[model samples]
Each structure stands twice: as C-alpha cells, then as structure tokens.
Target: MKLKLNQLDILLEVAAQGSIGKAAKALNLTQPAISKTIQEMEAEIGLPILQRSSRGVTLNEYGQVLLRHARDIDRSLHQAREEIDHLLGKAMRQLRVGFTSAASYGPFTNTMIEFQARYPGVKLVAMEGRPHQILDALQNQRLDIAVLTAGTSIVQSGMYYEPLYALSNTIIAGDQHPITHTTSLKSLMNYPWLDWDEPGEHSILAQVFRRYNLPQPQNIVHCSSPWVMARMMEQADMVSMWTSVRLRFPGYNVNLRPLALREVLPATSIGVLCPNIGRLSTAGNTFLEMLRINARDWLQQSDAAEMVARV
Candidate 1:
C-alpha cells in the first residue's frame, strides 16, 4: 500500500496518546483532521486499524502489526538522519545504552570510561534499570545495547549476548547487624530480609535456603532498586543477597559485609546484549570492543586474586 510517512506518524501518535483529540493537540491539528488522516490510512490499507470505544481509541490486531513495522521504520529514518548529519560534520555521534545494577558494579562502568576517552566526540546516554526493562528498550530501538546478568537459557531470538564474566551471589548484612557474624543460615530467619527478585519468581536467596532444606524468611521486603536496597540494609537490620563484586565496591563495603556462609550460591553470567552482530553503528562497535577488552582484563585480575587468596 502507498502510505505516506505522515500517515504512519499520525497512527503512532494516536496510539501513543490513546485518542485522536490528544494526538491532534500534540500534532497541532484539529481532532477532525486527525480522524480524517486515520480514516484515509485505513481506507488505503483496506482494514480497520483501531478499535474505537467510549473511553479512547485502542489499536486492533491489525494496528498492532502495523505499529511494529511503523516503529521500525521510524527508528530507521532517525538513524539515517543521524548518520547523514555525522557524515556532513553537522552533529556528533551518539550511543544509547541500558544496564542493570549488577552490571554497573563491575567492568561495564570501566568500559564506558574507556570508550569516552577513545571517542571524545561521541555522546553517551546510559540508563540503569532492571534486566527486563533494559531488554525491552533495546528491542524497541530506544537503546543500542544492554548490559545485564542472564543465564544461557534466557536467550532471545533476535539478540546476541556476549558474556563478559561470571558473578557469584553472596549474602550481605550491615556491619552492625545483630547476627552479622553468624555463620548459620538459620540465624538469619529471625531478622527481616530484603530481596531483589521479581514477585512470583524464586530468588537466588530462596533457592539457597531451599538447597539447605531451611525455611524461607517470613518477614521479607521485595525491592528492585539497588540504591534503595543498599540504604535499607545499612540503616535497618535487614539481610540481602547481592553480587560479591558489588559487596566489594567502596560505597557498599562501608556498611555492608558479605556473610561468611559455607554454602556457595550459583553464579550468573553478566554480558552485553545487542541487536544481531554487525548491525551496530561505528561508535557502538567501538564501545563493544572496549567492553571486551575491559572484561578480559577484569577476569584475569579476578583469577589472580583468587590464586593469591588460595595461597
């Protein structure tokens, strides 16, 4: 079908705003003009794209399909413009990245610093969120890459995961916690606990308790924000499961200490996720290379530290 770019733009705006009136206001047009554009698009496509109701307009199945393609086209056009501007020396290069809390505590931050040093003109936009949030942004083309912890079985079809390093989970408690020196997992049940796992899913801490045939802590608070969790753990008598690497960080180490538990928690893989290889911009490719180099150096250093500890 011969649909104009403006038609797609109207459809996207309407879907975003949830009504023709709101879309029109945002686009600086009248409600009827937006309605007519929608009607024209539907007539050209020979299908109803939206389902109208008393509340607001919602995308029908056909509209959902079309919206996906529309978003892809929109992203391509934006990327094309950016590329052309860079070629003409009218704009600086930019890269958008999303990362999880765990990734931020490790080599990812170092990689970003190294990238910035190498590409001084490249603008780096980094966002921190949960793994699912980061992955969603990457898939929607809002982000060029995502750094998060994932297992091998958690792969997505159109994404490539380049593993950086393995991270071990550890139990942490504030230094002043009553049972901070306790080695028994059962002792922790008497105090309140903090968990970062999504509701309805078994957390690594729960799994560790299960492995020992111990009952799960009853008074547990579920949270996903690392900053909140850290503050709560420091001020309250709460225990949490956190990455060992993070526990060693300067800010975290001030108040939090890894519990000396004999049980070892399973390690998870931290990696960089992106669209299929060879699809990134020049700046993105260079950043990815820096990540690889930093990750390699971090792993070797970690191994040497372990050897020294053993000796």
Candidate 2:
C-alpha cells in the first residue's frame, strides 16, 4: 500500500512494452528518468526486475509475480474510481455486445441463456458482424464486448483479448465419396469440393489453398450454413471443412467421412475482447468471467479430435 503508483505504472509499461525506451516514450518520460525509477523500484523490491539481452528485456520470474500483484493493486484503484464516478451518476448500466460467427461452433445460445439469467437487471444489446467489422465497432465505441476467433490473431488498438477456447478444423466428405484414407493435398483436389460461397479473399483457409497451388476446389453448389453444407454432403461427391467440435456434437445429423491429412490442423483460437482504456462496467466484467468459466467447463465435457485445416 505504501508503494508509489507512478513507479508501479512505469514498471508495468516497461514490462509490457519489453523495452524501457519504448515504455518511457509511452509514458512521456525521458529514458534516464525511466531507468532511474526502475533501479529504485528494484532496490525497494530487493531483486532484479528484468533480464537484458539482444532480444530485448523480459520480466524476471520474481518481477512477473510482483506484476500480478501490481495489476490487482491497480484494479482496486480503478474500482475506487468507478465508485466515485457512480456517486456522480456518470456510470453506465448497459452492455453492448458484438461478435462474429462460426455457425458450426454455436454455443452462444447456452452462453446467452446463462448471462441473462445471472444479470437480469442489466440492459443487453447484441450485434453480429464479421471479425474485422466487430473489432472496428469496438474501437469506435459502438460495442462493449466481443467474442471472435482468429489464428495467431493480434489484439488491435484499444482492446484487450482474453482467449476463450480453440476450435480445430476437420475435412469431411459424403459417405459415398471415394477417398476416405489420408489424402494428400494433391489427391483430395481430384474431386470437386462442396464449398462455402464467400468471395475469393485473403483468409487463413485461402492462404492454405494458395500455398498448396490448388485452384479453389470446383464446387457443384455453395452454401454458408454448415448444416446446409452437412446435408449437401450426404450424397454429393464433394468435401468440406468443419470444426472438429461441431462435427462431434452428440446426435449431430451429418453423415460425412473424415479425411486424413499429413499434419495436425492448426486451431482457431477464440477470445473475449473488451475496451482496455476506460472504466469497466460491472456487467462487462461479469460477462467476461462468464465466457471464460463457461468455455472452460465446456472443454471438460468433450473429447476433441484434431482437424484438417491449418493456418
């Protein structure tokens, strides 16, 4: 409690940026001032806070532990500020949610049901958009929270990302389709693909498609719904991709065969995103907690298979 907040902030900035100079620039302080503060703080803690090398600075283990404590300290400070703001009647009571979809990975209904049941008094506004579009809305102050998925996706400016769960991709073909054995990237293209009809654009899947020098799999038909794709695959000589999670859902009606690929597919990591700069509403924090806890519980209930799509 007696520690200086300014010093703690400086250390966090440095730890986060991994460069004292950059942290100093971020906090609008000179390099010498930043270095001096770090030295003094390390003395106070009686240990070195960082390791220096050609790769840049990284927090020492002891410093990392203290950083966690620092974050809790700062969070308490923020709560105090929020209480003061509420006393002035300036705090918001509503939450605006935005998210993108992988219809195949639909657990939002369960998540929404639990959220509304727990926070009956909070106003909820939900919007659906593509991944980039949802991020844009969050940056422009149109949304309070989002759930999105990307591979090795970086959190953009003004938001914090808490990873939720990973969805693995798998390739499926109709029961009657000829190839069910481990199909090489070349061999699979011998048959037409049952495809989702999105315009040709640079995406993780598209990138993989290009890497293999395969033309967009010639499709006999196109649809967006995985369920529709699933049904179409029942009798067609086509193959499609799905999250292993969706394909294995109990009593799922799809009758498709999994194709063998050479390497394990890369997973799509999903996350809950929220504003990093402003005060947190009680509702926003609660929703984030619910998302993480629920996703953890869901993972416990299933045995997942590795899928075919890799980024």
Candidate 3:
C-alpha cells in the first residue's frame, strides 16, 4: 500500500500523544482533519492501526510496526536533506555530539576545541542532556556520538561504546559545610542532601545508605543539572554525590568539597556511545579520534599523579 509522508507523520504523532485532540493541538490541525488522515491511512493499509477508547487512543500491533518504520523514514529524509544541502554548498560538514552534564566539564571540552582546529570547516553541534535522552538521540540517528556515564542498560542497548575512564563518586558539599569535618556517617546525616533526579532504587545515595546500614537521609532535594546542584551546595548546607573528577573542574563551585568517608563507592564507567564507527561521516570520525586521544592523555596523567602521590 502507498502512503504519504504526512499521513505517516500524523499516525506517529497520534500514537505518541495517545489522544486525537492532543495530537491535533500538537500538530496544529483540526481534530476532524487528523481523524480523516488516520482513516485514509487505515484504508490504504487495509487494517485498523489504533484502538480508541473513552480515555484516549493506543497503538495496536499494526500501529507499532508502522510507527517504527515511520521513524526510520524520517531519519532517512533528514539525511537526504543534509546531503542535498551539502552538495549545493549551502551546509558545512556537521558533527552532532551529545554529552551528559558531567562529561561536558572534562577533557571533552579540549577535544571539541582541538577537533574544530583540526577541521576548521566542520560545524559542531554540541548538546548537554541526561544519559537517557542522549542515548535516545543516538539510537534515532539524531546525534553522531555521545559521551556519557556507562551503565548496565547502556551496555545492554547494543550500541558500540569505548570506555574512556573510571570515576569514583563521593558525597560533596560546600567547602564550609560543618559536616566536612565530621568523620562519622551519623554526624554527616544531620544535614539535608541533594541527589540527581534518578529513581531512588537506582540512586547512588540509596546505595550509600544501604552500604552503611543507615536510614535514608531526610530533607533531600532532587536536581538534574550539575550546575544547579553545585549552586545549591554553595548556598546551603546540602550534600550530594558526584564524580570526584566533576568536582575538580575549574569554576565548578570552588567552595565544594568531597566529604571524607571511610567507605569507597564503586567506580563508574564513562564511555563514548555511538553507532557503527564505519558509518560515521569523516568529520564525525575525526572528532571521535580526538575524543579518544584526549581521554587517554587525561587518564594517563591522572594515573601518573596518583602513582607519584603513592610513592
């Protein structure tokens, strides 16, 4: 069956919004218009796609399959447009890169600078987002490469990843926080804390509590931005866990200090998540190589310093 791109787009939007009226509002079309489009698509395909009820609508089995192909088609169209623009000399070679908030503060910044210097004609589009959002973009082909904290789910998602460095997370607070002087976990619990906006079951804070056999800390604030967390700690008697490396970045709350704990949290893995390396554009591949070199250099320097301190 032949279907128009607009029809497929409408169907995808309806499935996403789960309400015809909401989808119409989002797409800026009338509800009747949207209904007609869906009807036409169903007629062309010879099967019902959506199951409607009093509450809203949901995709049936057929709708699921159609939505998946629609997304693939959308990606292809975007690539085709980019290619045409490039051929017309209207677009520069572009590499879209995404990074988790923590990844942005490190040598990745230098990698971007070096990549730009090496390929002066390439256009860079960098974004900072949570790991899940970055991963979604990578899977949808919206981003060329993403650097993020490597988690089990990321490794299991079937994406290609190169481990960059290992980071140990520790509780941090304003340098002047009274708890910084306290060596006991009990004393540390007296202050309110902040945590990343993650599920409690999967949170580093929860893991710390379990390790110490302590009750969950009270008066906690959940924040998503590392900058927000740093600002809060600078202004209040709050605590939160972050990569030790994150705390070391210049201009990232010079007043923040890692709490001295007898317990050591497991190190987190940081990595580059990407599609097949062979599929990346020349600009994308060049930037990826720069990332590898920068990561290796920083990790080696850190190791050397640690060894000297030990000696």
lDDT tens digits, residues 1-311, model 1?
98899999998999999998899999999998998998998899899999999999999999999999999999999999987757745223788989877787646888888888877888999998777777778888999888887643336535888877767777888888877454777877888999877544336567678878998889989888766888898899998888756765557778777788767567756888987666777677777888888777776785424411121
Clashing pairs in 3: none
Q: Candidate 1, which segments miss by more than 4 Å at Cα?
A: 1-92, 156-158, 180-182, 210-215, 302-311
Residues 236-267, model 3: lDDT tens digits: 88888887667666677588887887776666
Candidate 3 ranges beyond 4 A from true positions: 1-92, 182-187, 200-202, 210-215, 302-311
The digit string of per-residue lDDT tens for model 2 on 1-311 reads: 25699988987898889998899899999999988987888888788888999877888998898799889988999999888868634333677888655522445546777878876766788886656667778878898888876434336444687766677766778788888677765677667665443545414555457766666655435554666677777867777765665565543444776788874555667777777725566677777777767666666653422431323
Better of 2 and 3 by lDDT: 3
Better of 1 and 2 by lDDT: 1
- Among residues 3 or more apart in sequence or in different chains, the pairs in candidate 1 whose N, CA or C atoms overlap within 3 Å are none
Tell me how candidate 3 scores on lDDT. Answer: 0.79
Q: Give the range of the ten consecutive residues with the poorest summed lDDT in model 2.
A: 302-311
